[model samples]
Target: MVLVDAAFIIELLLKYSFPVLRDENDRIFNKPLMLQDVWSHLQLLENQLSFFILEDLFVPEKIPVSSYGEDAEKLSIISLSLELFTSLMHIEGIEENLKTITSTFC
Candidate 1:
């Protein structure tokens, strides 16, 4: 169940970045507030997954290369996450913030 939950969150992050990859019928994407709602639920401490588990699931090798010879793998999971949440959270200095945040976890 933990793996499934983690996969769901990873899928949310991926689809958040690439809207084209999202299922048109997905209820979460169909309702704007629903995504935020889910995000809120995920923020609860008990609902959280370990960062290592998320990283293992979203490893670079698991991502497929795109036509431009680039993949979402180029960005760390932290960056991909910030790409979605930073806007919702109204964060500033994303690049610098990412660096500082990533360093702490390292």
Candidate 2:
């Protein structure tokens, strides 16, 4: 269950980072509200997979840096997680708050 959860989150992030990778038939991205629903579910504390598990499973070193272009820093699980979560927020300085939360955990 843990691995499945982690994989799902990681896959969603990848699809988000590179829209070219998103399948035309994928219901998650195709349905107007599905992606938002998924994001909301991710906000639930009990639904989270530990960052360590995600990082370890992500294998960042194996992925080519060139694929991320100049913003290679965004390739990390932390950045991807932030990009996803921050999209749901309308608050000012939410990125800073999210960074603080992540730093506390790391």
Candidate 3:
């Protein structure tokens, strides 16, 4: 399983580039669970990414939804991705956090 960053996934959606999606050598697993946010973001973006996901990677079982934060609310890919990017842009030790997450998953 190949874990992908939510931000990268959104980039793929916005850019309409799915080179990673097309990789048949490994099964794709979007981590730090955020499916709803991804759907919501795509919805706002004129259904571009939604269309791609539906046509390309629509495996219900593979799309895992994990809990987050105090409420243990389920995160979507869009929110997660935006949060990740926003935090990284503002935080001082973001490089370290980025390295840790990327090394652990990607």
Per-model TM-score versus the true fold = 0.80, 0.76, 0.24
Candidate 3, residue 92: how far the Cα is off, in Å: 13
Question: For model 2, where is the 10-residue window of minimal lDDT?
Answer: 60-69
Q: Relative to the true structure, how large is the alpha-carbon lDDT of every model?
A: 0.77, 0.78, 0.40
> How would you encode candidate 1's per-residue C-alpha lDDT over 18-90 as one tens digit per residue?
6767777988989869988998898999999998898887765555433325554434678778888887788
- Model 1, residue 87: distance off in Å is 1.4
lDDT of 2 by residue, 33-106 (tens): 99889978988999977778998899766655536667566777887877766676643566777678778987
| Greater-TM-score candidate between 2 and 3 | 2
Model 2 quality (TM-score): 0.76
How far is 33's C-alpha from truth in model 2 (Å)? 0.7
lDDT of 3 by residue, 1-106 (tens): 1123334564444222223334443223243335445545645644344434433443323432222133223133433344544543454545567557656764
Global lDDT of model 3: 0.40
**Which sequence of candidate numbers ranks them by TM-score, best first?**
1, 2, 3
TM-score of model number 1:
0.80
Q: Pick the candidate with the highest TM-score.
A: 1
Best by lDDT: 2
